[model samples]
Target: MNENQQSMPPETPQTAAAPEAAAAVSVVALPWYRRPLFWGILLFLGLLLLAGWLFWKEWQQAEATKASVAAQTEQWREHNAALESFMQQLRALLAKDPCEVKQGLGRITSPAGVMWPPLASGADRSDAVPQKPGDLADKSGSGRSDTPPAPAQNNADAQKQIPPVPVQKQTPRNVSELMEQATVLVLAMKEEGLAMGTGFFVAPGYVVTNAHVVGDATEAVVVNKAMGRPFAATVRLVAHDNGQDFALLGVDGTSGIVPLKLAQSVSRTERVSAWGFPGAVTNDDPKFAALLKGDEAAAPEVVYTEGVVSVILERNPPLIVHTATVSQGNSGGPLINEKGDVVGINTFIKLDDASYRQSSLAIVCSSLAAFLRGAGVSITMAQASESAGGKQ
Candidate 1:
């Protein structure tokens, strides 16, 4: 009993203390929920889960936006297609019956007497006109007013010293003479090349021609019959009346040109002359073709032919039918009566048969007068016509 007591001499409370301490150490070494490393791992896992959820949400929104844009694009394409189809239908309807007037053929006959309308002033048959700058000098002061002298010229010596007013006689004697001076060959150039037609001077620095003659051309050139020098011209304005074509051109450098006067009256079955450079004459004659091709120095002269008024076709726009021969290049030539006055514009010809027996047609003076008045151009002659308000 003494030897057992010596071996357990220090075992009062220490034996239980050492076992409790060991148990406490072992529990601390094992991982717990409150430990720093364990908490770090848990936080990392939570962050990963949160990132995955956000990525899924963004992908869903992107898919929705892409689908919306695709739907709108499809709708616009369908709308454009529908509009294009509608336009094609409208164009097809306008293709038929394009012209306003449907002209007709009349019986061909040769009348004896020319039908002429009376003048607006029957007693005023005189052809007196204002003097031009280049007219022959006249010493008579008949044109000026014979008023009493002013204060400065009250003396008899002042009256004798006053010079007489000189008159100018620049008017041409006949239409044949006017053609040599004022007729011009109009040439229009475009992407397709050169197009040829005829024109005549109506006023100083102004020429009248057909609109079809200057087709698709912004500008044109006029070649004189004498010098053949090309004068630059601008297409100022164009007017078409129920298929009656007219164009007003503003020309440059018309110093000595004597323009033809417009006739206030036109008579049916009257003797008239058509003057132009006809393509029929040019295509057939080698000399004229050479002149056009610039192979010859001599310019082509104006071609004149006489004929009687055949028939007056009254339609939406009235036309004059004459036996005067004309062709393609004579589109804008002048139709002058025997009184040296412009009565009409040579425009078109109707083909009668397969041989193309064509009838010469012209826009009458009445239609021309109305057009010029509407265009605000002042004419020296009166715009008097029996058929003034007849048609377009």
Candidate 2:
């Protein structure tokens, strides 16, 4: 009975915590490498971090390299430009400076004075001039009481002698020559902004853009694509004619400007080329185009439009009419002919939307220039105005 009761029960039973520990010790734990999910996660995280860092570093390096290249290129360009300018000066020194252009001696002597530009377009003095009389006084000096009769041969010879009329090119022709001597410019203003119309070299150190472009400009910016630097400019001449729907503005101090040649007036049915900063063709502001704004710029810069004279009208002023279609910015631009001479001033147009066309309108430039001269502020006009100067 005592053995049954004792029953090894008291054989020291294990504690709860102790039994759990013994069971865990019997189970085998899985190795981290053999747990495929764990290993894959680790690998993926490592790759993501490494790739990100590499990309960042590469970006930084590329940017640095680009900056370096740009700087080097700019330096080279500037150096080359300076060298070329110096060479030009040296050549001029070797040759003759126009500033040093003399009048007579060795083709260098100074002449009397500046000659006034002769009549430009309208008036012709060919037949109105008086002829010089030769030896009439000598013939009369025979001291005859009734003046001895001249021999028929002498009279006939005297009658045959004629005075020569001065042959000089008019204003339009000379205006082009002056322009050919000018430099290029990018026009702008203050109250407004960039100039509205296109401009070209009208005379040396001068540019001919539209008057309205520089009309409100307290200031202007001049740039020659060939030169690549901006310069200050002022309006020198203004041939503003709204009725004619054209104006001429002159920029002073630009050299080597190429003045477009002008042709005498012509009727409708003539073929002509229209040139301007239409903002629909080429772009003067290339930077804008590069900035993804190329589309908005329909017409900018210098562009040409060629078409036949759609119509010629003197509705107001004698105008060259055509279907060449012009934009607003075309005002004061040159309407050139096959000969490359300016035939008109790109001035106005009436839209023909139905035809998807534009009616070309231009002021016969030769006539307008003449009219401007006629209404000009000449010395004589100034004097007269002063004499009759009334306060407006």
Candidate 3:
């Protein structure tokens, strides 16, 4: 029994020693660079480092995107605030219904609410009547025909048979509906005068001027420099045009003052004689004091200038027009003619910077006349004697 136990123990120890020796030999036989376990450990460490780098790069990108969003939000907030403020101011201005423009707005305002005279009790309030289109039988009430029909009237023969009436003998364009207009001078006390504009006489006293002028004027004074004497006038109704830059002035023309005539279908090149009393006709150039500058002004009478109409720019852009001469004080002056007719009002003068000279431009009174008519005033245009340009 003892010998058997000893042999078994030896066999067990031999088996253990043999397996250890074989493992050592295998370890020694392996190439130094060919360790699978070491290679696997290195690969695991490399994967961990690459994943960490990718996560860091993703985090940085998210941070950049968040910063960009913040900047945009700030900018939008500022822009929205500015827009809200502007809208509020605009609404406030619209509610005022003011006649004259504020400090910032200049002649930029539209021409509306112009008056020719001041309103007064028992004043002629004719401009309040809208002038309707001429009827087949004009205001004269002289039915369709004053003469007998031509015998078998061929168009050519009938024209010849109709003797032309002398211009002087013909009735005024619309004597039944004559309206007056006025001019308003606007000043802003401390600053230079505000907008100065033209107004037409409606009734005996109502005048229409651009509302912007009346809104700025502290006091308004009217003059009828027409009758070799300056007649002082007063103001009545004043309203501004909502859609345009126009004002209406009501004046009392109860005095025996004759209303001026309006020219419709006027020439773009009419030889006009613009007249206005822009301050006692100041003769800054004494040379032109005794002797007027142009042939139109005879006795230094209210500064008359000869200029042909330049343009009729209703639909044209760069509406700036041209004429012979104009000045600042001539804003509400009438553009007249040899026949002593009012054609337009002097508005603006474009300068020739290179030559240091200026050409005049008058806003044609056609549309203005219509506006006056709508405001209960009437205007009549005579048969145009001049062509579209250049008088005979």
Instruction: Give all candidates' CA lDDT scores.
Output: 0.62, 0.47, 0.43
For 1-392, candidate 2 gives per-residue lDDT tens digits of: 68788775554445547878888899998998899899899999999999999999999999999999999999888777766665444333323311231111123211223111111111222222111112211133222334545777877575457322211232334423323222233345323223345555443444455555455444454443332233345555554443433333433333333455445555556667676656444334563232112121121235556787766666556767766656655656667655555666665555443454556667775665564454441211112222221112
lDDT of 3 by residue, 66-165 (tens): 9999999998887777666654553444333232314433323222232212111112222221111111101121222234433344633643575322
- Candidate 2 ranges beyond 4 A from true positions: 1-186, 190-192, 237-242, 245-248, 282-301, 371-392
Runs of candidate 1 with Cα error greater than 4 angstroms are: 1-173, 283-297, 354-356, 382-392
Q: Which TM-score value belongs to model 2?
A: 0.43
Which model, 1 or 2, shows the larger lDDT? 1
- Residue 151 local lDDT, model 1: 51
- Highest TM-score: which candidate? 1
Please estimate how well model 3 matches the true structure, expressed as its whole-model Cα lDDT.
0.43
Model 3 residue 146 CA deviation (Å) reads 64
**Candidates ranked by TM-score, best first?**
1, 2, 3
lDDT of 1 by residue, 139-227 (tens): 12232323433453344355357632221224556657668667877766533335567898887777888876775566776665543
Candidate 3 stretches with Cα past 4 Å from truth are 1-203, 208-213, 224-245, 279-301, 316-322, 384-392
